[model samples]
Target: MPTPGFPPSTLDAGGGPIWISELASDDPNHAVHVVRDLEPADALEALGAKPRLFRPCELPRSKPDKWTSLPAAALGIEPGEVPPG
Candidate 1:
């Protein structure tokens, strides 16, 4: 049985939730495999790949006297990543 606010799971041989097996087969698109929580530059160096970090929602809001300018990179998400109507 799954607890409220948690994902479903199966019973292990010893009757515990089978978390390890589930993690081993985790969805590639949803999983984040990191040796450590590294900063953007450090993470790129360690993984030899660019690292993407989500910005805080409040960070994008316009200030009291200023207009907001959204970055093109923020609008470069894949079409499939957008929510369906």
Candidate 2:
């Protein structure tokens, strides 16, 4: 937890809430969430989501070798490797 004496950083309001969400890793459930908009973010959070690390560069989660090229959506985890939620 952050110390209560820590000062709150002020936000510059310019772009839409989308921009704030992007900077906050687009995941409101994260501990480091910086919320500029509450409506939409609240809806998504009510649905239950884990705080996931965001990759702004859209890179795949795993390193690919000489013979294999993987899609970004695969998340570096094999299809059958993870059980259904």
Candidate 3:
């Protein structure tokens, strides 16, 4: 029987802590796990009426839209190319 509201168990895998519940349902054959501290009740409650649901392929490829404009070296720009005071 599958456990409801309970994430999968990832014990003794030598990786990090993982939540089984967050695993995508599409791949039942593969085990699901999540890093520790990734989930918190307070964080979920912050979502209020718009709680996000995780899907197999719905994993985020990048940061949220609001943060896209922020200056980030990873996007590009050599050290000297940046404006200096």
lDDT (Cα, tens digit) per residue for candidate 2, span 21-52: 34354334444344434654464465565335
Candidate 3 lDDT trough over 10 residues, lowest sum: 17-26
Ranking by lDDT: 2, 1, 3
Task: Count clashing pairs, candidate 1.
Answer: 0
Clash totals for all models, in order?
0, 0, 6
- What's the lDDT for all of these models? 0.39, 0.40, 0.35
Relative to the true structure, candidate 3 has a C-alpha RMSD (angstroms) of 13.9
The residue pairs that clash in candidate 2, if any, are none
Against the true structure, what is each candidate's TM-score?
A: 0.24, 0.22, 0.19
Q: Which candidate leads in lDDT?
A: 2
Model 2's alpha-carbon lDDT is 0.40
Candidate 1 segments whose C-alpha is farther than 4 A from its true place: 1-31, 50-85
lDDT of 3 at 36: 38
How does residue 55 of candidate 3 score in lDDT? 17
Q: Which candidate comes out best when scored by TM-score?
A: 1
